[model samples]
Target: MTLLKLTGIVKTFPGVRALDGVDLEVEPGEVHCLLGQNGAGKSTLIKVLSGAHQPDEGTIEWAGSTVQFSKPTSALRAGLATIYQELDLVDDLTVAENVFLGHEPRQFGFSSRGITRRRTRELLARLGHAEIPAGREVGRLPAAGKQIVSMARALSHDARLIIMDEPSAVLAHDEVENLFRVIRDLTAAGVAVIYISHRLAEIREIGDRVTILKDGRTVAVNLPARTTPTDEVVRLMTGRSVEYVFPPRSAAAPEGTPLLRVSGLARAHEFSDVSFDVRAGEIVGLAGLVGAGRSEILETVYGARKAAAGTIEVDGKPLRRGSVKAAVAAGMGLAPEERKSQALLLGEPVYRNVSLASLHRFARLGFVQRGRERDAVGAVTRSLDLRPADPRRTMRTLSGGNQQKAVVARWLVGGSSEGGSLRLLLLDEPTRGVDIGARAELYALIRSLADQGVGVLLVSSEVPEVLGLADRVLVVREGRIVREAPASDLTEAQVLDLVMAGERAATAR
Candidate 1:
């Protein structure tokens, strides 16, 4: 029997037709992948199916009956569950509480703790993940562990259809394999899985069929995963020709004084015995899965994280250890992963965010001179081409891409004043949340920074981004720096392999 079917589904967003007459069909015990770029209608289609939105016009037939869901609760009642990229679990609640949030197991006509714990354990065990203590707070758990809890919660609804958006995005490679196992288990029991991801390799590995959405419409349907190449999928999603394979790159790094070097760096539970250097005009990528200690290693270098053992030197001069001030003084700047959370103060004005790092120079006696700050902010705003040209708008009010530009403007402007050239720019997912056009500009900026003798360390989970942007790639796994391969010599499979084989192989040479 057909599990679900949608025909002529349409949805429109502001100034964008997010979905236009899309079609999809799924069968019982089949894993279907919804493939597209960030702005593509994949998100819209999933939202419609999961009852987050009402399609303007469509016929949804499920379980041999035509139906319409008014809201997510109705969809859940109809046995459809959605696991979003940002999961909707309450951090303050317990794992069991989050799992059975809406409907709790009550005893004697009242909620009972003992029954909830038992039910939570049973569901988690079925999912092959029972390590999540029912009593422990959800916030205390790591990201990976929390995802398992989310999955458990989804299963608690007894969903006949499960939609996972970017399931393995933040997971280690081995963890991805484990997820595949769980998926296989679910499908074996005659349940359907709707998967969405940017990682094409995983789509090929686990998906039985694929649906391609582009420009708010379904371009192709029921494409066999085995016969269809990733390049074809990429072409469909991007609507442009892209070389799936990389060209041979042969370019020597800049031969100059070491811009930034760390010796014997160690952070507890993060990284150990880590050391490397970025030369002038060099773009080095730190590649690893989440929690492989890649971000912590960079944070330690930037003095954001305390190091147990390490020595940082800038241009042959020793830096003061364990101090962000000292690292910035030594001309090191970092754009962290959580741009909105870690990098930008959302409530502040755009100008304030731009001048945050170097306010002292624009101020006299610790009093910020508004005129000087405005002029400095204006110069960067025009250079970066930020829209609205509003100096007074709050950072939170700006769109994602523009806010990202503002954050970069902060360091780019201040870094220039600290030194004529940008000394070191450590960017974690710099092009993240930006549009394709903005991404190209960010890449150009990185290249320009490198040309200006700024040593750049680009950390990203998106393999193709690192492959495209970095001159050299250092694959890290299990808190140690693994193989160091030039961009020309490196391949996505090779980097993923290193991440999969963690700790035991722990590539040291």
Candidate 2:
């Protein structure tokens, strides 16, 4: 019997029909993989199943009985749980308290901390993470540990079906492998898992059956996960037979004095003696595993972090260390890795967000000019092919790909406006959380900026992205630059070998 099923699910929000006549089924002991591009109704369907939203039309069947989940608590009581990409755990709460937050084990109508901690310990052990102390605060744990705690909370509710959305987006390679192992064990115990992810290789590895969603409908259901060709899956999800292809490299090498130069840059334990030069019209990439201090280096160079040693110069002029204002004034811009938390104002409109750095250009007589602001922002957004093309749209309503475009567009506006020309652009995981179709656009956009004589400094965890898009690559390991080579001189395997060499050396010692 199917553990859970949804038939003809229809959901609509203001001006958008997020899901239309979608169907899905999950069987006990199976990992049901859900694949789709951004804005393709995957999130809406998950919300409907988890009782975050009531479907406008459709029937939900759980355990062979038709049911309606009016709220989140109702779905949890019925053995369904959702783990969002941004986990909802309170950072200040202890692991035990988080696991049994609303439905704590009680003795005589009073909460029992002892029983809660013991039960939480058992769940962590079952997930193969017995080392996580129940008394420890959730914020103190690492990314993988926090994820395990999320699963433990679901287990505390006796959840028979758990929906995980982009669980590995923040995890490193080893941590991702561990997560898969836990998923396998959960499936072995007959718990159903609805796994949603953008990585096709991961779906092939961990999923038993694949369901493809496109434009709010399930186009293919129950395809064998391992046997299906990636091209076929891409076709179904994007309505195209190809994934985002990287743009061709520039034929001419960049010339002239460096647009941005860093010498002997050091930021305490994060990174040391990092030196690089980005010439006008050059794209240079930093290639490393996550937590290799790539982001920290970018932040330091951009003056977000004070350098313990060394100097940063833009256009041959030194910048004030640890001052973001100075970096902006010096024609430096950064699209950080975490756009939502570090860069964007989700509550504002797209135009306002795009014009954030160039606000002075739109100001006159101690008042801001809204029309001028929107026009300038609109031009940049159009050039970037921002969808819906409506600057008035709330920033939060757009897809991940469009949001990233806006972040890049902000700098484009500031670069050309009377503020200052953008000489050096720092992109941290520019395509993170973006779909394949959107990635191609961003790749082309980055190259286009380079062709316009803007020096680009890129940091990406994906080795191939660095190799394909960068004119030169810097391989970082253990808080230092271990190797530097032309993009043509390095292959993915060679890069990985260099990256892992640090780990091997440490282990040997």
Candidate 3:
């Protein structure tokens, strides 16, 4: 039986018709996968369903009766729950508090903290995560643990239908398996799931049916998820074949000295004896599972963290340890993983954010030359194909992809004003929260930067990303470099096996 149906859904924002004549149907106990490129109205449609936004024109039939959700609480009461890509848990609250937020059980008109903690523990156990302490702060948990807490919250509401937006985006291979198990249990209990993800491989594994949306409209509906051809799905979502092709590696060999060289790099208790060289026009990728020290290695090299022992050189000049200023002075740039908190000034205008690193060049008598700064920022933003093409807009208003572009554009414009050029670029999880179309563009941009003779050191959890974009690949496991090979010499499966084996060994020890 159809649990819910939406017809002729039309939702419009001030200047954009976000959802135009969209339609959807969901059956109980089925995983209905929603497939779309970024900006394809998936978000808008979900917002409309969750009562965050009301459709301008539509008919919603719920359990054989027409209904409208006036607010999020109304939708929750009607058994609809949404877990966004960025988990909506309150970091400062305890696990129990976050799980039962807004609907805490009461005893004699008083919030029963003891009962809440006990029930939270029960819910965690039900979700195979009993080890998570109910009283522990949500901020203390890792990404995977936070995911479990989010799921526990959905179950707390007794939701018959749950919407999961990119739920597995942050999970590792094993964590994804655990999530699939949870979804299977939920479906067996007659709950429906509206799943959204950009990973087609995941859809094949966990989805029962698919609905494709494009340019604010549903292009196809109720296709067999497992059997549908990937090419067909990509074409539907993007209106093109959209092959995941890496830009061709330059045929010529690098001829000059390495732009960046690290020897005996070690961050005590994090990584040890790590060594690598990225020459101009080369991309070196580090691939490993989360907590395997890939990001820590990058951070230590970028001078964000102190290295207990190591020698780092840029163009034959040694950089001072644990000093980002020294690293930048030596012609190095870093685009960190957590862009929002670490790299971007959210409330500042795009021009100011992009010009942050290069402000010294536009400064005279302790004052900024605003016009020169704007002109330089505009050139870099345009070169990166930043949308809206306006540098005056606040950084927070831009999408994830655009924010990342602005982060990269900062380095492009700043590039060591005291030196000849940007010798090396450190990128940590460059495409973490970006969409498929934007990923392709970012890949192209990274390659273009390499072509301009910028040495690139990249770390990504996705093995394919490392193999596709890097000229050389380093496999990190248990705070050590377990293997190193040319990108063409390694396969994704081989990399996974190596990483898993290292993890298993660490666990055994």
Better of 1 and 3 by TM-score: 3
Candidate 2 local accuracy as lDDT?
0.90
lDDT tens readout by residue for model 2, 1-509: 99999899999999899998998899999999998888888888988998999999989999999999999999999999999998999999999999999999999999999999999999999999999999999999988899999999998889999999999988878889999999999999999999998888899999999998888988999999999999999988876787657899889899888988999999887999999999999999999888889999999998889999999998899988898888888788899998998999999999999998888898999899999999999998998999979999999988899999999999988673447788788999998888888888899999999999889999997888899999999988878888888999999988888777756534322
Lowest-scoring 10 consecutive residues by lDDT in candidate 2? 500-509
Give the winner by lDDT: 1 or 2: 2
Residue-level lDDT tens digits of model 1 in 269-309: 87898888888788899988888888898888888878899
Cα deviation at 445, candidate 3, in Å, is 0.9
When sorted by lDDT, best at the front, the candidate numbers are 2, 3, 1
Worst 10 residues of 1 by lDDT: 241-250
Q: Candidate 2, after superposition: displacement of residue 230 in Å? A: 0.9
Writing each residue's lDDT as its tens digit, candidate 3 over 1-509 gives: 79999999999877778899998999999999998876788888898999999999989988888999999998999899999987899999999999999999999999999999999999999888899999999999999999999989998998899999989877877889999999998899899999998788889999999999888999999999999998899888776675475788888766678888899999878899998888999999999888889889888887889999989888888888888888888778889988987999999999999988889888999999999999999999999999869999889767677888999998888787564357788999998767677788899999999999888999998788999999999988878888788899999988887788856534432
Give each model's whole-structure lDDT.
0.81, 0.90, 0.88
lDDT of 2 at 250: 88
Model 3 score (lDDT): 0.88
For each of the candidates, the C-alpha root-mean-square deviation to the true structure, in angstroms, is: 4.0, 2.0, 2.5
